[model samples]
Target: MRTVLVLTVSLLLFSCSPDTDDERIGISGDSFLIFGHFFGECIGEGCVETFKLTESQLLEDTIDDYSGQQLNFEVLSDALYQQVRDLPDFFPLELLNEKEAVIGCPDCADGGGLFIVYSKNGTQQSWRIDQSKGNVPVYLHDFIDQVNARIALINQ
Candidate 1:
C-alpha cells in the first residue's frame, strides 16, 4: 500500500510540473515581424525608417542606414505603437513560402524600397520589395500600401 501511494504521488507531481521541452515552449512563443523602408539616395533622419512589431509592442529602429541588414530598436510611445500594432497581422503568409527573397529591383533607380522580416513557428523569412507598384507582384500591392500608410501615420 505504501509503495502504491508513493508511485501515485510521484506520478501526480510529474504530471503537474511545467513542460520543459524547448520545442513545445517555442510553439507557444509570440511571433515577431520587422518592417521598414529605405532610400539609398535620400537625406534626413527619415530616409531609412524601420520598425519591429511584436505581440505586445512596436519598436522603431534607431539605425539610419539604408540597409536593413542590422537594426537596433527603441520602444515607441504607447499611443503611437497602438496605431500600428496590428501591422503584423497584415503580412501575407504566402511570402513565407516564396522562393525569392527579393521580388524586384529595390532602390535600383533611387526609388525607395520596402524591407520585411517575419518570424513564426521557429521559421523566419525576409524580403526586399520595390516601392514602385508596377515593379512588385500584384498581390503585394495592398500590403505595400498598408505599410506606406502606417509609416506615414507614425511619422505624423
Candidate 2:
C-alpha cells in the first residue's frame, strides 16, 4: 500500500511540473524577437516605435519611450501582426554569435537608430545598430531593410 501511494504522489508531482505542460510554455521557453526604431531628438508620437514578436503573437510598446530597455507591451491587432509576420525570418544568424551589443554609434548624428532583442533557447541578445548603411555591418543590411519595410507597413 505504501508503494502504491508513493507511486501516485510521484505521478502527481511530475504531472504538475511546468515541463509537463505544453500550454505553460511561453515567450521564455520559445524564441521571441523585438525590433524597433527610435529617434532621440525627435518629438511626437512617431519618434519611438518598438515591437515584441513572439511565436504566437506580436506586441507593441505602449510607452513610446526612447530607451530600448524594458518597455510595456500590448497585443497588436491581427491585421497588424500579419503585416510583419515574416520579420523574424529576416534575422541574421550571425548576430546570434556576435559579441558587440552596440554596433557603431546609434543616433549619434540624429539619423535615428534601430534596436533588436532576440531570445532563443537559453540565450538572449540585443543589438543597437546604426541607421546609416555605412555604419553597420554589411551582413545586417538586408535585415535592416526588411525591418524598415515592416515598420512602414505597420505604420500604414
Candidate 3:
C-alpha cells in the first residue's frame, strides 16, 4: 500500500507540471514570433500583423480578409534581420506577471496595443499598453519600435 501511494503521488505531480509543447512558438527556441493588433483606430477588425524572427531570416505577414486583401509575405534584408535579433533584452520574466497584464488608465484616450513575447523555457508574456499616453515600459516601447521599423523596411 505504501509503495502504491508514493507512486501515485509522484505521477500526480508530474502530470500537474506546466505543458510547453503546444503549437505556439517557444521563446528560447531560436525563433521569435510577435503578433498583435492596433486598437482604437484600426480598419477592418483592427490592423493585424505578425512577425517571426530567426537567426538566418525574418518573415512578416499582414492580413485583412474583410477588406479582401490577401496575405502578404515580406522577407527583410540580412543586415536588418541581424539588428532585429539583437534588440535589447527587456522585461525580466520575474518582474512581469506570467499571464496577460493590462496597465495604465482606462479613459486616457490612448491608442492601445497588444503584444506577446514567447520567451525561453516555454514562457510567454503579453501586455496591453496605451501608446498615446507615453506611459509604456521602456523595454516594451523600444521593442515595439524595433518591430515597426522592420515593417517599414519591408514596405519600402
Candidate 4:
C-alpha cells in the first residue's frame, strides 16, 4: 500500500513538472538559459568555441567542489565551480594564473561575458570579472600553456 501511494505521488509530481524546456541559469543576471546539456555546443556571440560541460555537472551532483558549499545558482563561485567542473564530474575551469584563476563564460550578451575568480589554493576569489568583453574560457592547462607560448613567440 505504501509503495503504491509513493508511486502515485511520484508520478503526479513528475507529470506536473513544466514541459516547456529544461532551463539553466545564465552567467550574467539570468537572461540566457541552457535548456540541455550539450557537450559540444557553442553559445553566446563572443565565442564560436564549443564547450564540453559534462564535468561541471551543472545539472546536478551536490557538494559543489571549489568551496564545498551548498550549491545554488545565483551564489555559485569558483569554490563551487571546482566541484561543479571537476574532471569527469564536468570540465575544470579553463583559465588559471600563479595565484588566481578566471573561469570564462563562452557566451554572454553583447559578446561580453564574465569570469569567476579563485586563488592558487583553489579557494574562490571574492573579485569577479563581470560582463567583460574579449576574455573567454579555453580549458585551464591549454590556456596557461598558450599564454606562455605567446610570450615566447613574441620574444622570438
Candidate 5:
C-alpha cells in the first residue's frame, strides 16, 4: 500500500511539472508561450496610437506539435531559473536589434526564444515589432499577458 501511494503521488507531481512553458499565455500552432503584459504606443506623423496587453496577453506557438524535450532548454538559459529558460538566441541578434547574452551563445533559436529555425509550413520568420523591450522581468510578464489577449482575439 505504501509503495503504491508513493508511486501515485510521484506520478502526479511529475505530470504536473511543466517541461516547457507553451501554454501559460498566448498560444499558436507553434510551441511558444508567454506569461505577462504588453504595451505598444507610438506617434506617426501627426497621429498617435497605443496598445496595451493585460490579462489576455498570454500567447503560444507550437511548431509541428514539438515540445520542451525536443526543443532542449539547457542550451539557452544555462541552468538559469525557469523564468528565463529555453529562450532562443539567434546569431546577429543585433540585426534584429537584440544583444548576445553570453560568449559562444551562437543563435538564440534552438535554445532560448523561437529563432524562426523551427518554422511551420508557411509561417513568417520572425516578430517584427517596432519598439524595444528591455529585459525587465516585470515588463516581460506584462507583455506576455497583453500578447495572450491579442491572440485570444485573433482566435475568435
Candidate 6:
C-alpha cells in the first residue's frame, strides 16, 4: 500500500510539472542552469571567480582589487542554451566529490573549478575538476570552449 501511494504521488507530481516551453525560475524553456566557482588555493583571500548562466542570461563575478563585481549579459541564444543543457549529461554526478586522494601532484598549485547544472524541474548535477591533478574532463573543456566561442561571437 505504501509503494502504491508513493507511485501515485510521483505520478501526480509529474503530471503537474510545467510544460517544457514554460519559463520558470528565470530559466527559459527546458534549458538547464549553470553556476559555480573557480578558485585557486588562495580563494579565501579574494582570488576566486564565479559564474552563472541561465537560458536567457549569463552572469560573471570576479574579484578585482579585492572587490567583487558582477557582470550580466543577455547573450545566451537558444542554440547555445541547448548546448549548455546537454553538456551535463556527459558527466557523472560523483565527479563533484573531492578527488584530492587521486591527485598526482600534491606539491602543485591547488586550483580547481566546478560547474553545476539545474534542470528545469530542479534536479541538480555537478562536476569538479582539479587543475593540479590529472587531465581535466574533455567534455568540460569542450563546453567551456563552446561558451567562449558564443560569447566572442556576441562581443563582435
Top-lDDT candidate index: 2
Error of 4 at 81 (Å): 13
How big is the positional error of residue 97 in model 6, measured in Å on the Cα after superposition?
A: 14
Number of colliding residue pairs in each model:
0, 0, 3, 12, 42, 0
- What TM-score would each prediction reach against the true structure? 0.78, 0.78, 0.49, 0.20, 0.20, 0.38
| CA lDDT, every model vs. true structure | 0.80, 0.83, 0.51, 0.31, 0.30, 0.45
Report the lDDT tens digits of candidate 2 across residue range 48-138.
8999888778899998877776699999888888788777667777777689998878899998889888887867789999888899889
TM-score of 6: 0.38
lDDT of 1 by residue, 11-38 (tens): 9998886654421212125677888898
Off by over 4 Å in 1: 1-28
lDDT per residue as tens, model 3, 62-153: 55332223446578677766765643243233325434366453224645454444445555455555454366555455555655565556
State residue 103's C-alpha deviation in candidate 6, in Å: 10
Worst 10-residue lDDT window for candidate 1 reads 20-29
lDDT per residue (tens digit) for residues 1-156 in model 6: 999999999999987966633322335565555544344456363344334565554544443221223334345455544444433434333344434423223223555444344555556444434444245554345544543444344334
Candidate 6, residue 59: CA error in Å?
A: 3.0
> What global local distance difference test value does model 3 have?
0.51
lDDT of 1: 0.80
Q: After superposition, how far is residue 87 of candidate 1 from its true place, in Å?
A: 1.4
Error of 4 at 72 (Å): 2.0
Lowest lDDT 10-residue stretch of candidate 2: 19-28
lDDT of 6: 0.45
Cα TM-score of candidate 2 = 0.78
Q: Flag clash pairs in model 6.
A: none
